[model samples]
Target: MNEEEIPDKNIFMMCEALNCDALTELPASYSIRSCRPDELGIWKMMPFDDADSAKEYEGFMSNYFTTTYSGKEELFFAKTLFVCDRQNKPIATCLDWKAYDEFNTIQWFKVLKKYEGQGIGRALLSIIMQRLEMCDYPVYLHTQPSSFRAIKLYSDFGFSLLSGDNFGIRKNDLDECLPILEKFMPKKYFQKLRIINVPKEFEDMVNKYDTNQF
Candidate 1:
């Protein structure tokens, strides 16, 4: 298929955004906590496992490892942060770390349906944001309108948005991935979930992301 060709139903999104600083915090927690080494894969796969297209989600995970994380799931595990329940069940998760050059992003953020309203996701993301703020580079993340709930959280944390049509978006990216962006999220709906990017003049590249993988 050509670059401008339409993507299939299984396609993912590439919307981009960045945060100049961390602007969120977590509520008090007496039971749930960060993921431990022994409880990695299960938690990492929980959100995808619960999806209608589990196979596609897993395939995307593998592709992501190849393109960004050097195909090393272990390295990703080390970089991941999962909030677990008293019995060690994965409640929420996120990965905030260096992705390319000085760009650090929050990846694979999720919260199980069973634990959505209690602030686990907010707390977990806050912890990751704290880690990112200490880093010297700019913190960024890739999410789409489908991840509707995340828009507010990322916006609150200062992540500015750039869609496929945004001038700040690089020509190469827009040309090669525009179809997928359009398919994953129509331009009109995507605009509503948009965020502002810091250093507005700098060009933006959207990585393969579906922040609401859950």
Candidate 2:
């Protein structure tokens, strides 16, 4: 199934400041590190792991790597990270990617379902944010209404929703997403969401790439 066949809501966000207070220590049994070359397949599938979505993601990831990391496959694998269990099996993954070689953006951040409640996500995000701290300001990311929990986590880390009509080739669903969030998220978490205008620099960088493949 191609992703566009399924209806989805997309939202864009920006973080002007890193909130160190949101950082948490990883549980003792798991370790965080760069992904191994052999784990490229694992890194690609972890976030969108359901069998039904496999076809869609396989296509998406293939295009993503080819268009976004073409000659930088080695760098992609080196920068891609995983939170591994005691057995060194990857349970979660993400990376601090520079979109269009202009500014920082968080990409493919996810934790396996069984590992969800632990501090692994926060810990991994904190480590990535630390790596991105000096690279650029106002980091950006793309997500959806379904990821309300992660959105709350992002807000805790100082990311605010971008209230605008578009982000690159994608339409901003911030307005539509708010009602869904309010209906689905607990009132407190939903209430804490903040909004910000899109900065020209971030807008330009996002549009810099011809992301039709994505």
lDDT tens per residue, model 1, 1-214? 4333443222122224334353445545524455565764455376653656555577666555566656455766776776766665666778865655335567778887777777667667777766643443455555544454565566555554543343222222323343454455545654544433334333333333322221
Please give the range of 10 consecutive residues that has the lowest summed lDDT in model 2: 1-10
In the range 117-168, model 2's lDDT, one tens digit per residue, is 8888999988888887554877888888878778999999999999888667
Best by TM-score: 2
| Backbone clash numbers for all candidates listed | 5, 0
Q: Compare the candidates by lDDT and give the number of the best one.
A: 2
Q: lDDT (CA) for every model shown?
A: 0.53, 0.82
- Scored by lDDT, model 1 comes in at 0.53
- Stretches of model 1 off by over 4 angstroms after superposition: 1-40, 49-52, 71-75, 134-137, 163-214
Give per-residue lDDT, candidate 1, residue 197: 31
lDDT of 2 at 117: 89
Pairs that collide in candidate 1 are 160-195, 160-196, 160-197, 161-195, 161-196
